[model samples]
Target: MPFPSRPVAKPQLRAHSKYPSIPSPSATYLVPNTSDPVGASLGGVRVVNEGLVGIGRLSGENVDKFGETQGAASGLYITDWAYASGQFSGKFNVLPDRGYGDGSSNYAARLHEVNFTFTPYYGTSVVPQTQVQATYVDSTKFTYQDGATVKFTTGLNPDTVGGVVGARTGSLFGQTVGLATAANGPDGAQESLLSFDAESVHLFPDGSGYVSDEYGTYIARFDATKKITGLTQLPGAAQPNRPANTPNFDSFTAPTTGRRNNQGLEGMSVTPDGARLFALLQSATVQDTNGGQQQTRNHARLFVYDIAGANRENPVAVGEYIVRLPQIDLNSDGSGLDGTAAQSEIIALGPDSFLMLPRDGNGLGKGTTVPILFKSVQLVDFASASNILGQFDNVGQAVSPAGVLTPGVNAAATAEVINMLQQDDLAKFGMNTTIPANSNTLNEKIEGMALVPDLSTEQPNDFFLFVANDNDFQSSDVKMLNAAGQVVSRGDGRLNAGITNDAMYYVWRLTIDAGAKFFRMDVADAP
Candidate 1:
């Protein structure tokens, strides 16, 4: 689509630099566990400086009359990278964000543990591999580790589980407990979520790291064995099915209740020194809007936590900032033809600065191009931004239209980093091939991101940017629906009858002034 109106001559403002000296940026690409139907097992696992790990037992779906095959598991994606002293080791880990592989409805929504392995060769390369490994989902079931084993009904508030008989109610659940399966739609046994919508996992050196989820609070810590040893609940964040009349805690609800269903906390990161932890909401909180689909709010929240040797209960939010994500360019009917951009992942670069991946659903552009809409990464800083948490508390803002980011008001500062969808950029990353467009379309949910040192180069600032996508286990034509399960529209035209979104990975050379601070150490020395 050419510019309708004559556009002013634009000049590149970036200061050209010679960095990210890696000849090849990507390696062994993996697929999600297509075996499970309901739950697309833990989609992605990334432990900085540790060996890459991913495993799947997929049952390929008949995607195209010819092209790639699709998986039947919940359409989800998980990605992880392997590093040593902050350098790529030619392997990475991949997983599907699946629930407790229990053959129940929860399979689609309630995922538990994920089994992944180090992929040395994408097609047939065997550099150094982290054989099939597992990460067990921690127990959020209060007293019992297996939390989703109870029976419940559909459409009912999911929080009721905590108050149920034999549950870890009241005192056991921090004086309150919410439901993790509210968005799951119906009743299910063994449907409990270990980490609600586990989005990204950042493991520490000592066989322990934090896993961030879009729901079930914001973040939690898992032991080397995969047991969730600690948890981090975002302010105003809570589960569903709480006792009737109970207050809504998950503040980022879609209906302006707490958090829009499924849009809770999505991104999390820790400093290279492991002294600080960072997390952000995928979008505004429910107190702000009903859902990101409403397209009314773009002011997302970024919270920082202190994790200097602190276990599960130790990491607490020390500061908060606003990240106004890119707004969608909608049609009169509020639909995006090209796509809509939303913040999916973030990585801490330095003190109050970081890089963000705000992508759109339009997929990569044609002729080996960038996504027409949200497909690039942004560099942002919260150092000079004001903490408006008090402002929202003083006034009913950030939830509805009561108050928004007023012009002239200083918030987080952001700048364009890279247009990942560009075919040229793909080549620059050593892919050397354009993302072929067709019935087997590759437009995907760009969800995972990680930065590592480019040890292969001379510049100390040289590093690798790992970007990943979650196919949501989508196989052919998918019906994009609203909260009501009503068929709202169809997805990628390529999926009219195309390929399965093979959980994919792409790496790029990134020259960051401050090299990535990764905890690349043996598990025994994490502390």
Candidate 2:
């Protein structure tokens, strides 16, 4: 019983005083005011004009300097910005996990630097030639920060530092444990000590940052040179600890207690002041899920770390809270619950509040006919939530034993900020929430999110939230590469097929309440 599809309507183009003609592939829509349901739920925050103000895109078949296919971004961060000489220009970075190999071949984790200029149109009376223009800077493969490239392997290795071949260790970051094998690894692929599966990335003012991983559910710090500097491991409860003293990182095999395979830290953020770091799991850990039931993964964990001052290298877990993720209807019908909508990324508004994107696995790139139900950027507040740091940071401890929070434990407060499924908003972009989604439809996996100030003197509180997608390297005409940087064929042989999913980006303009204490850029030109 899927939801009925809405009638496809032509885009309503409007001219603005700033430009005589409307820009192609970009539009300025009405924002949601206090009276709107989404705005009302914000309590005090506001969304300027219908939410979305601009959109940009990158081709799926785009390749890097290494001649390897550039996959969709799993994370995003604005490294620098400026508003001088009557123009707005900025530089940012996008994180792409193990290349087109998925979990089979050994692909290196990398980052793509992009430079762009933005010509914002706040109202219908003001249009510009180009709403948002972006250009590729270059791509860099992550290293041990000691001259060694990190590989994305599914095989396991023993814990030993450098100088030993195949030793499971990082350069400056020493010995690693809980080595496990993924169920989908090739029959025989080389194992390496420098394995990684990058998900979310957050940068500090100095260009150093942390990238959350899916394999170890670990967060590794990187220097300005994009090299690994330090590592922060999660508590035992968040790791996949196998029974019989053996490692089992395979997604198909259930660990005695720990994170489910592939369901590791997907979203992470650091406070603007660089005093704290927040890491969120994609969903519930193995133990938190009621007997491996995916539907019960609604109870996810949010870990807060003290990374201020001396704690930068050795971050301490200060607080852990339960974030009840939303459950959606798998059938798209008004029926029983399906499963938890996995969260992809998060951004800190303050030490006590942040923005989270939780979405379903449907839409354009999924190759499914189901209609998308839920995909949104939500505001989460942990001001009054109970801290379960010490008590639940171990094996056998469950925050919600029966699919609900245990007594005395309080979950974080969440309010919808931007619902990507809104028919009116998607319509303006030539997108929709229809069954058997088309190329023009909204793509699945809106994972990356970054916030920047609007830099307007009159509206000091306004900001732009950039949302991006993870295309899964579904380009029909892209070359696949192996660990040795050699071109290879995809196992499925759909390389030159008809399927093509581009890396999509959507920009939403929002107005935050001054009292909310949202992070603001300190650039000289910033209002």
Candidate 3:
């Protein structure tokens, strides 16, 4: 919700009447369609008439005139603004879960098919940057080559079934066997071990399909040669604790690492058949190494890894699930201690069920706020993770206080005035629903999720989630359900009227290939 001012620039003294002169259009500038580097704009937001404005004028030539009117599908290309801001947020490691478009025509070469963005002071402490589009296709046309294929469905409409699309036929990231992390560290220190913002990708009942990093557990190995192939350890980190192992803690600190793969990891969910993997680390442990000036704020953790063989690399931590927050125990009790709450995102629905979106850090250094959806839903059942089945907080039975109230609101005398103003705002954010203060209205700093299935052939685990409110870009909210997590429906006109809240704004990451639904936005005008 940031771009909207276009009617102020006064000071034209001799400003004649309002009817006559109408000739002032020159402001082109869109040459970069090197003939298909992969493109598609078709046209959406091109509002420009650019007429006159004499007297104390102002027109930095309509700044590239919105890519000269998106003609010829457009694929703008230019490169090296320090290599496009050092591939900010870096992602897009290769997509084509099915619908291979990007045949390119150049409307400013699809702004390098934007893989990620939102940190130009977004929400705070920076951290939201990702971009990957170096362009190289030798062997034949579609070339991200090797065997490239990604297909998953659930965009809905007979669209196959459920979701799980993947493809990476080799060349994982900037070459050298692929996967690369460990950047920034010296002073910005978020510490990246082959970095990963939030990605889940799963299809395991044996057909094999995996991808992790809901909070940087970093596991990757789509296999069949698609490249990504390794990194997934934890059956015992090397098995030492003996006694069958269950109580041993030493490292796993920094940026808070525990729960489902610690360090405030945000959102990720996997389980159509895949053994299980749902990590959402959001905060706390932030050790911030080398520079970003000493750190550690709010500590958050939540892990549940267990992918034993055939490409899970080895992953086997089973369960940790820690996110208690009593406003971080009165801001870390001067001498008593209870501090810890960091999680960027998470979403996994099966073998234990899952859904977390913690990030109410008040926008860290300042600004980005709004995401904080933790209605207490973490169902872990990794065989030995010790069964939790339900954590519950259905967001005060689906919101009330005259705002959104659900559970089929019929107002049994306003249900005790909406349960005493939701227990007086859950005691100003320190008494329940897992605790993590910020005035608590739900929203819980979630970054992305789009599930939708439930085509109702008797409700095969029903769904519809949407989520994504990274603080701006029109805020966000959508929820419909079945399979126990009730609710049934909510906003955006009943969430885009159906096929699941359509799409728009910094979704950062969303997957459902095969059935065709690939996403990764953030391109502030490219041409």
Score each candidate by Cα lDDT.
0.43, 0.67, 0.25
Q: Give candidate 1's TM-score.
A: 0.61
After superposition, which runs of candidate 3 have C-alpha atoms over 4 Å from their true positions? 1-221, 224-301, 304-312, 318-321, 325-445, 448-527
Each prediction's TM-score versus the true structure: 0.61, 0.82, 0.24
Candidate 3 displacement at residue 491 in angstroms: 13
lDDT per residue for candidate 2 within 1-527, as digits (tens), equals 12112222322332222211111111111221112223312323333323677666777777777666777788988766766544567876888775554454445667898888776544444232245677888987665633344433322322323443222333336534433232212233444435567889987767777888877777988787777777888887887656623334444356667777667889999987788899999988867877745668878899999999989877888999988787766666556565678899999877777888988887777776666777877777777789999888765567787576788998887766677876656666566776676666777778999888765343456578888888877776556555443556563322323557777777877766535543566665522
lDDT value, residue 182 of candidate 1 = 29
Please report the TM-score between candidate 3 and the true structure.
0.24
Per-residue accuracy of model 3 over 1-527 as CA lDDT, tens digit each: 11112232322222223211221111111211011101011111001111111001111111111221111100111111111321223222211111111111111111112233222211212121121122221110011122343211110111111231111111233221111121121122221122232233443323234444322234445443333445452222211111122211211222121222223233445544456566544442222111122122322334566764532665565564433221222222233222233433344444543334332233211223322222211112222222221221111111122222223322100000001112222333222222222222223223444333212112222222333323211112222221122222223221111211111222211111221121111123221
Off by over 4 Å in 1: 1-91, 98-104, 108-177, 180-195, 237-253, 289-293, 331-340, 364-372, 389-403, 406-409, 426-440, 476-495, 515-527
Ranked by TM-score, the better of candidates 1 and 3 is: 1
- Per-residue CA lDDT of model 1 for 379-422, tens digit only, reads 66776777655445322245234226554546676655565534
